[model samples]
Target: MFLAFFLIGLCIFYFYSIKKFVFFSQKSIKHDPPVPIFGNHVQVAFGRRTQTEVFNSLYKRYPSEKIVGYYKGTKPEFLVRDPEIIKHVLNTNFSEFCNRGVRRDPKVEPLMLNMFSEDGSVWKLLRHNLSPAFSGSKLKSMFPIIVSCTNKLVTVAKELALEGKEFDACILCARFTIDLVGASGFGIDMNTINNEQSLFLKLRELMFIKSNWQMFLYGIHDLFPESFIKKIHISRPQVRLIIKQILDSVRSQRTNDTNPRNDFINLLLELGKVGKISGESLETDANGKYKEMEMDFNDDHIIAQLFIFFMAGFETSSTTMSYAMHKLAFHPEIQQEVQREIDKSLAKHNNKLCYESVSEMVLLELIVKECLRLFPPAGYTSRISSNDCVLPDVNVEIKKGTKIIIPIQGIQLDPVYFENPEQFNPKRFLHETLQPRHKYAYIPFGEGPRKCIGARLGTLETMAGLAAVLNKFDIKTSPSSTRNIHPNRAAYLIQFIDGGLPLRLTLREKSSVISNGFP
Candidate 1:
């Protein structure tokens, strides 16, 4: 009798949930039939594929689709395949699609209320204050920190080169970035470069634990109604407490310092002094004028910002560098091209890396650009309609609160924009040849007013990481390495290699000697 009752309850639940899944069919939009609770994400939820693979597959399968309907569980999501429609959503008609579709209640999970996650007034305020901190001049001031960290990276490469065994590139780059971010953002040497058991490494392990269960819960956040998400706190409490402690400790140190450093910590400290910020909101009144909105930079807000900065700092640059190394390992000719560029730049700067030095290496930049094409760190980006808006190209009206998915990886791989897209061809990014390509088709760092604020800084740091490795050693595919690299299923949005990017390093005969006076 009990078994029969449980089966009856489940049947009722499934039938009730299907009502929300009819959103696409009502609008006559094309979409795959959704299953009970997983919607179209059963494969992903069950760990059969990563989000990148799922979106990329759907995108290619619907070549004629201007906008394909999707479901993140019962939550309706629309996949934007056409470049013109993508432009309208991302840039031209941005305000209408400015909100993140997912509901965020900071009281329940303060850490989720970050620049990357929040929208409307809160996002605008944070972006306005954070924007100046990443300017060229500020990055120039941070160059020494990058140089010092990359030099340590080179030193680590030397030891690995002597050992002559394949090492995990993901872990290796993670260490370098941990040190750089720890020093630049918090004003402390993380010491992760040389020590495997570094506390910061342990801290990161706690911060981003990957599992099928975590991914399921993430989907559930979008799956349920806003009321359900608002009532529950998803971020780990123990993790939140540890991060808060770190934030408090750092504030104290920077506060007591006489000559404060011009770094990320100092930048945030300066913002905190202003108490609050008022900005022209992304949302507008019926008159179409942007309304004004303001927000405070309290301890909760400050700590949340710090968490994103720390997480983004270590994750993005490290993922890019690891993927870049993987490409170089497989394509020696392309690797040789970038190595020559690195050598010329280092020689020009007397074996030292400076901010200006990075700009001069166009070939190296091309390599990084192409690497991002294949393995964009974020893989995809999202937005929601704040008001009813018609897609300019398709003439389809998107209703308020409808989610728009921009598949960055899929667009980058589309043959319409790129020929032989799977081939690792850095020369495709040559300035002379890149003019005619669709601008929106290659958004490793998105497009429009809401694009990543740290694009230049992040790209520069990644270039430096790759430059350091190529400067000291040659990256080659190991005997254990395969041509077909598997994406890590548990890495959430990061395009992590499953077993890590394994590559062998050999000391370069022509490497510029880093003596005592290089810096």
Candidate 2:
């Protein structure tokens, strides 16, 4: 009887697969052929090539397909390749596609309920309450923190020069960003730059490394939604302990009431107070707003927000800065032009760099934008239909459970939107004709209301570190580094493919000094 039932189930599944493919008209949308069960992601799902390389290869193969349907096991997903459709997914019909295909069941993984894991009303509340933290005024206030970190970075670079050895600026940058995030996000003075073996540095490695099976899990999670599989539990005893220590410090500082200042933690504390009162007195809105007026931040919410910010801020900015340096090493002309611009801007401020002065560096900003185009920190953004909805410029109907992928890597490197897409040309961004190419063509930080909340802080942190390095040293590709390095996809997040990239740096004694490494 069991054998008979198994065979019957197999027949049903095989027919269902055929019927589903026919009903969806999968071939009409996809230029590349989807495998019997694997779909277009055979290389990625099976771990043959890196994620970036796999997607890049597919993108090159079918450059003109506006949409492609592929399977993650038996689950069907669409990779939207058209610029206008991507724009709609990102902006116009955003409500229909607000939630990403990710879930961190708070009951199971308490930390998952944080900003990155949530959607709908929860996301709305977290995002709304936190938006002010990164406003122009807030970032302006936070500029001094960045400058402090950058000064440390410059000091480190100089010390390395004195040692007369290659400094892994990539690792150094990570340490600097970690310190900046620790100070601003959690109110911890984790001077990771000076003490390479600081608790913060170790925690960062523990939090972000890609081990054998651990590496495979990133792809598995992305390919197969967690609801369908058993949850992979990660125990960060050290991280949890560290956060408790940090919170204890915060609570102790609050008790003193002697040195209360404006920082992210303080802001969250104020919101928590407001949220608590609002939870009682005011009648709540449909979206969980209080109709009666009492406000206080949930204790967990504060921790979650801080957790996401620290994780997102430090690593994303560090990887991006490193990749930009890699791009510069290959394209020295662009690097020189940016260096000249940085010098010109600094000279205006008497060769002293400040937040306002950094803001005014147009070419510097363009270079950053161009680098982001090629090596987006978070390469792709995924969304699920919040509700069944039709999007503009497409005939295909999106159902409630259907998954949508915005191919950032594919679109950013597509020639149709960006002429000579592979070339690292900052001027492409400055050209007037290319100005209106596609709204979604350059969405490294993303677009519209749901864009990266930490964008301003990320940009400031990245610029500060890059400016500091440029001020003290000349950066070049190491002979050990790949000629044109590519990212490893299994270790997704912040665009790093390999364990890390290493650069060789030489001290800049005079403005016009040249070295063997210089192109």
Candidate 3:
């Protein structure tokens, strides 16, 4: 009786997993064969490949197909490779495809419910409340904090240059950005620059290295819907502990702060006092008019927002800065040309690294944009239909819960949109030299209303870091450094370098005061 029951269970398991994965074939879409439970993501789920690698492979595999179908376990997902189709998914009919495939419950996985991951009414309310914090005026107000943090970066880099030994550029930049985010976002002095063994730095590093359960959780995160996967926890215990501690520390410090600066912490404090996040809803009534919605803004919600802010800033900006530096180290002539631009801008602004001066660095802007094109931190963008709708360009019908992927890395690297896409050329972005392509083809910070909220601040931070380093130091390849960087296969979400970026730096004999700051 026992043997018979075991055999029956085995058959049922196989039947449920394999039989339900026929949506692609029934729709007559192109896709590779999937395994029983792992589906098409067996490699990523088991930690053998990076997500970007999988995206690029699938994208290049079917060049002719505008939309390709694949299975994430028993669930069917589509990869929209065509720019026209991508635009529809991202903007044209955004209301129908607004969820980023997230259905995690806030009570169970609260930290994951930030603006980046929340869906529908919750996302709408958070976006409304947080929009003002990233405004041009607010970023300008946060400029001094950013500048002070960059000075710490410069000082640390000066020490590393003087040491005359190769250093892990990834860790160095990560420290700088962490400090910047802490100061600018929360109005606190993180000062991780001086202490290499800081727990905050360690926590940041450990966050990306997924545990066994986390790997399984994220692997199937989009594969199954909320109905099947209820009460799932989002982060590791240590990650939660550290983030909570940071929040507690901030709250305690602010109690004594007579004058809280214009920052995220103050914004959060105000939200706490209000006791709710109310705004015009992203969802409209049948009449197409938006309704007002109020969100339950508890302490967990605040932590989730702050968690994403720190994680996003710490990983993305550092990767860009390190990659840009690595590229400059290889192409010194281009580095010199960019340095000239930085010098010119600083001189015009009376040798000060202010908002006005940073804006004037056009070449610097081009370089950062090109870097984003080549190495978008998000790798790929995915969304699920909020309701069934036919895509405008392709006219293909996707169901209410069907997933759509915009492979950002793959599209940016396509030779059709960019010439010699692998070759790093900043001039390709120059308006006079840029070839006309679909605007949706290059979305490093993504496009449309649901795009990256902190893109401007992140870009300015990247530009400032690169300018400061180049102004004061000469960098070159180190003996330990790899000529080309490969994304770490083990990374959870962010595209981390396979090995930390290592480079040798030397202080420039002729450096300007603006290398650190204007004063």
Candidate 4:
């Protein structure tokens, strides 16, 4: 009798799981056929293909369709291809697709409660409060902190150039950005640029190396948010303990301070002192009226924000700078043009790398923008519908809880929108050239309200770091470097180079030439 009952239950489960494979068929939307439990993401789930590759394949396959349907396990997902649909999802009908749909149990993983992972009311409130911290004035005030880090980077680059060493640009830029985050975000000197064995660097490395079992656990959690997967811990206990200890130590030192330091930690501390984060409501009631809402800004919330700040701040900026260096190495003439612009700008600033000087390096900025277009740090972003709605231009009805993916990399590389999309062309970003393009076509920092708050800061850091290096030294492709870069299949959301980016460095002869107007 027990055996008969078990067989009955197994049959029921099998049909129930496979039922979702027909989701797109019923909706009349095009999609790849899904298997029972793996859904359409079999390649990604089994590690045969990275998420970016899978998404790109689906995007290319359905050229005529505005949206392509897929499944993550049993959950239905929509991959949006039309720029109009994307704009609607990101801006026009934002209320219906506001959340990123990344649910996290605050009790199990306190750090996951950050603004980046948060949904709905909590995200709105936190974003409102945190927006001021990244304002123009605040970033300008923090410029000196970034300059100090850049100075250290220049010192290390000179030593590397003098020794005629071939180094991985990926690791080199990561160390520089890590040091910037340490000083600017937490008001601590990590000295990672000089100290190869820094504890913080080890922690950063460990965060990216997830075990196979851990990846399975994350998949389970993503597919079955209401199931027993909540009990599974996504983060390592040792890492959490170490991060908490660091936060506690820093908090204790700043608790009694009256003067504001204007750093990220101090900014959060100030917001916490206010007790609650209030904002205009994004949600409307049945009566069609918006109401004000507030969320508590407690210690856990503060720690969560700080954690994301450090993670996003360092990772995105460093990856961008590394890729920029890689591109410049291959294109020597472009590199020379960028260096000339940097020198001209610095000459006006008395040979100092200041905010005003960096702002004047237009060609350098264009080069970084082009690098981002080719290799966006966050290749794709998703949004889940909060209510049943029709997409603006396509008029496709989307059900509540359905996931929508915006393929930033695919859109940026699509030849339909960009001419010779594979070629590294910085001129595409020139003001007049950019004016005619679709606004949503190039979204490295994403679009609409949920766009990365650290966009400006990240750009500043990348340009500043590049300027500092190019001003003193020249980058060249090393024998260990690969002409064709491949993305790491195992990497998390960020698209990392398959292997480290290796490059050789040499001091620029123009470094000794002082401009007539500057010291």
- Which is the leading candidate under lDDT? 4
Per-residue lDDT of model 3, residues 1-519, tens digit only: 999999999889888888877878887889989998768978887778887888789999999889887777777889989999888888887888888965566677767778888888788789989989889998888787888987888888888888887898888998999899988887777889898997878888677877777777777674555545566665676777787888888888888878876888678877977788898998688999999888777788788888888888778999999989888888889988998888788888877888898998999989899889898888998998988888766677877878898999999999988889999999988753446788999999888889999999899999988888887888888988777788887686678887888898988777667744532
Residues 1-519 of candidate 4 have per-residue lDDT tens digits of 999999999788779989767877887889887888778877777666778878888888988888999888888888999998899999888888899987668888887789999998888888888888789998898888888888788888878889989998988898999999988888888899998788877777666655687778767765676799887778666666666777788888877867657788887877788877787777778888877887778788887887788778998899999999999999999999888888888888888888999999999999888998999989899999999988866677888988899988988989877889899989888854546888898899999989999999999999999988898889999888887898877677678787979998998887624332112
Candidate 1 local lDDT, 412-508, one digit each (tens) = 9998888899988888877536468878999998899889888888889999888878877899998877777777776654666778788899987
Steric clash pairs (candidate 4): none
Clashing pairs in 3: 352-518
In model 3, where do residues sit more than 4 Å from their true spots? 1-4, 220-229, 432-434, 515-519
TM-score to native of every candidate shown: 0.94, 0.87, 0.95, 0.94
Which should have the higher lDDT, number 1 or number 2? 1
Indicate the residue-level lDDT of 183 in model 2: 79
Off by over 4 Å in 4: 1-11, 256-259, 284-289, 431-435, 512-519
Clashes of each: 0, 24, 1, 0
Compared with the true structure, all predictions reach lDDT values of 0.81, 0.71, 0.83, 0.84
State the lDDT at 387 in candidate 4. 93
The predicted structure with the larger TM-score, 1 or 3, is 3
